[model samples]
Target: MKRSKKVFITLMLMICTLSTFLVGCKKNDSKATTKKDFNYYTAEKLKEAIEKKEDIIILDIQVKEEYDKHHIKGAMPTYAFPVKTDEEKKKIDDVLGKLEGKKPIIIVCPRGGGGAENTYKHLLEKNIEKDRLFILEKGQTGWPYEDLLEK
Candidate 1:
């Protein structure tokens, strides 16, 4: 082949390789994966789980006063309500460190609102699997099981 034809072929090959590489390196969204939200467990279900002695971790993120006033029994308190600041986020580290095993983590926020979602997202960022996390339905505010609460 002529030199020009050889160079042209080489260029085409390089372009093809580059195209393949770029396509391969593309950030592909998860396929067939459903968009996830907080897997909420009702207070009733939580009570049942407790009664059945099922393995579960209740992570309470209420402030110290609120938590002391009334909170779920056996809940691991981070005392980091709102969980907005880096320090408050760090507060959860103690409980997070102790969080092991395959038990589902039920997050007990004050109102089961943004705080819970934030904590959930933070946990995901900290390498906790989404499926293993749950937000207490309506949080502590809507929990009707007085017996389950530790005042």
Candidate 2:
């Protein structure tokens, strides 16, 4: 083939290759593959929700004894502390499993608590959305609301 014809063919091939790549890159550019779901509520917001009687679940992530002693009113005790027994492990799994698909899960522990934070991380690793999970910053010990339970 002549030099000019050869050059023209090579340029056309390069153009076609570039076009294919560009088309491939352009595919599905109009929509995002993932959507953000869930919302993280601040301490004040959580309090407000509780006061207003909104749809939410308060999770007490502390030792069962501490929970029994004192915890946020209407909060379900979900002991996330170190598990020393199969029954405890089962309880944790049962609690987490139930909360996994449930949104508005508010996690709290005693004031100056640590266990709930670890459990929160675990839940995140288990594919829990950050927004779906919220930590009651001050925990039960500092919670302004009064504990409603029969002593």
Model number with the top lDDT: 1
Give the alpha carbon lDDT tens digit for every residue of 52-137 in model 2.
89878787767878887777677877676643355544555677666756558787766533455555556676677777787666
Question: Over the full model, what C-alpha lDDT does candidate 1 score relative to the true structure?
Answer: 0.87
Highest TM-score among the candidates is held by which one?
Answer: 1
State the lDDT of candidate 1 residue by residue for 39-58, as single tens digits: 88889999999999999999
**Cα RMSD of predicted structure 1:** 10.4
lDDT of each: 0.87, 0.66
Model 1 residue 25 lDDT score: 65
The C-alpha TM-scores of every prediction are: 0.75, 0.59
- After superposing candidate 1, which stretches have Cα over 4 Å from the reference? 1-36
